[model samples]
Target: MAGASSRGGGDVAAAALRRCTATAIHSGADPAWSSRLTRPRERDGMVVVYGDARRRLERRATDGAPAVLRRSTAEEEEETRKKVTGGNGEKGEREWRVNVPVVGGHAGITIVPLFSQAVPKANLADEDIKAPTKRTQDGGTKVVQAKAGKGSATLSMAYAGALFADACLKDLNGVPDVVECSFVQSSITELPFFASKVKLGKNGVEEVLELGPMSDFEKQGLESLILELKSSIEKGIKFGNQ
Candidate 1:
């Protein structure tokens, strides 16, 4: 991957995104992969970005990698990811670790990372996709289940926390159109809600790229989602404004 393209860790992606703001910098090749996304940070030249994305994606499975945070110390991040989907299962039972990145600010339903567009794009319905997607979405639920009705979903959630953090890192490191179906400010609907495939760059959120055309089911889902999304945003905004 050397000689491809790279940048230093701190807000490198943001620096690249600022290029488009220039009054005279209007060519097309400007790091316009979707303006405003940030690149990954570098440390000892290890490239933590890839591992982050991989873990983020893996979090959906019952076994997600250890937790790594977007804005936390490295030691804390790794410690977190390992906590969940950990302990070799209960009673020292062997449990496979599958990392899954649940992007978007944490919130039930509000958080919407796209599993359909995952790297290879697993051909799965909501249920099949749900297995991972839902598991990730409800990573909390899994934790509660594993807790034996004790504490709460802590470890696994941390794993997802790290994966998402890493994905953002990778995108910023000149990762060539690093695409993650994250749930950020988007235009898939009129709601200003979450969708996927946002091109990460120098900024925290480079571009809110389209979700392409929706299938009939997807279209219906989008339609309904917008209504709910709009309502949610309006309520949040209105409440915040007040």
Candidate 2:
């Protein structure tokens, strides 16, 4: 078992898996299996969880960015209320958080954040939508640059891996409706694999949810990302076969 980022991490893992006989458990930003694991005889339960998507949404909410949604504890809510109302018991605007479902492969343009489908509606202007979308896509690059190329987003990647593992455990223990967005072998789109909301259960992925409705902006983002994602998947498969 190992954790890695999406950029070339999955491709390397795929090649390594090809040389081994044991079942491998990979937790990272991309679905490392590619076409190999999608075969009927080689099928194994796997999921790609991108934690940066959630982190970016959290940053936006805390920064008072518009149309963001949040999940907060009662104590945190009370503290926010006091700050917003100036502790004068006056009603003021409340803070919110965003839940953006990230799809496609985990890479530069391959990462797609469906802000229009965000919870509580990210009702952002076109420019606003573009900003976060690009940020989500280039998040790993930004982290690398910030550290002067010393390391990647190892901490955040670890957190996302742990979170997904816990979800898988709960589902295996009979937890119902344990839903999470994951990159898996999907028929929801023309691509062989895609990232979308999925219901996890004892047998692994019980249901793959549809992308639902998409705003024009979101639709365009999805369309533009497919070619690059397909190329990356194919590249991984080629490496595995070599």
Candidate 3:
């Protein structure tokens, strides 16, 4: 009789939890924040943050220069980050340790790093993450900007496609701690799930850590980000499915 009663109580607790979760979702609240006060685990999110490489964005944010000039600056910076030697040397090897995330929906200014909430934490600078974010976010406009009577940067499109293939290849080779930040459906947000950091591997993401604790700066950033991220997500879903 006691065992049966305990089981019934457990079911009631579970049901209440589900209802509460649904309510939070319906009301547009990030449930993770309320679920705890301070989390100690260092988690990774759905975006990769590298170091220094994002210097291109620093210029864009400050540029009084024309949009085309800003884009030109960004392109130069991106080119600088790469190391090419494939056809040039057969005995030579080139590897890039730069971090990248497959963030959902164009990888724009909404580059929400799921770093702390992701499996493995990658050390990165704000510029590193932010620059790529701007590129991803504004890539559509970039295409428009570059196509001045001429065709376009079909080359850029192909490069991204091939980069994705390479990332997949490396992860398949049992590369330890292969990671990419991508938009993933998760229990982390008010919505069903949102984009964040995810660790890539031979079998895809093995585990997703919680978003852990945030510094005051991060907390404030997150507060500012919620509305924007939410709006973007809604826009995508509406446009894509409808």
Candidate 4:
């Protein structure tokens, strides 16, 4: 189910998951199979998925960067330069659409964006980073506020879901180097399920990438988010058991 953040949508998605689990049980299949992809909107799954994809597709042109970097189109290059330089050789308000690597859990303060690792290298001041970081964490709330109780960010969420689904499909089809961030059964952290970049392959998550060199701010954000993320994961497990 796409855009399952709303209460009604979330209920439907949960029911669907339960049904899938039930079917797996009946068929003597492992319900905890890694090949299964559950897009839970309660956790902002698509946001990180699409964000990672954008990082790979659009923001990969830095010299001496990782393999994720690529030669971007001229337009993309211009946009990145403009956004980072503010078109006047002075750092300004960083554009929200830039390729930002979001980590941690998918809710509130747990939604940590490593702006220090943002592509095109937006050298934003510490004061300037605070606003966008908060905005990233409160993205859903901002949408609700902007809509005045009318609706949530359904359209954008749907688009993100589509992008994630496509990436999964491409990986399943034997595409190489198909890496995207996902909340999966992980050993990268103490948490059983944590969001991080993972290499997709025919067998699903082939490898979970490490959280490469983080700035002090990102490290602190990760540290602060762990407790809340652990609490949320525990709660979800408790609810699922019930």
Instruction: Provide the TM-score for each candidate, comma-separated.
Output: 0.45, 0.61, 0.40, 0.61
lDDT of 2 by residue, 1-242 (tens): 22223344445544433333221133233323222233423322222122333333234333423332222111001111111111111223232333456777666666666767665454555666676667666665566567663555555554555556667767767889997777777899999877778898776788999998877877888898888778656654554454
Q: Which lDDT tens digits does candidate 3 get at residues 90-187?
A: 32333243333323233233443322222223343443334443444455345545554234334554454344445445666667765443445677
| Candidate 3, run of 10 with poorest lDDT | 21-30
Question: Which model is ahead, 3 or 4, in terms of TM-score?
Answer: 4
Clashes of 2: 4
How much lDDT does candidate 3 score? Answer: 0.37
lDDT of 1 by residue, 18-68 (tens): 332111111111122212222222221122333343233223211222232
Over 19-102, each residue of candidate 4 has an lDDT whose tens digit, in order, gives 221111000112122113233442334334333433332222222223321211110111111122231124443454556556
Off by over 4 Å in 2: 1-24, 27-97
How accurate locally is residue 167 in candidate 3, as Cα lDDT from 0 to 100? 49
Using lDDT, give the best candidate's number: 2
lDDT score for residue 21 of model 1: 18
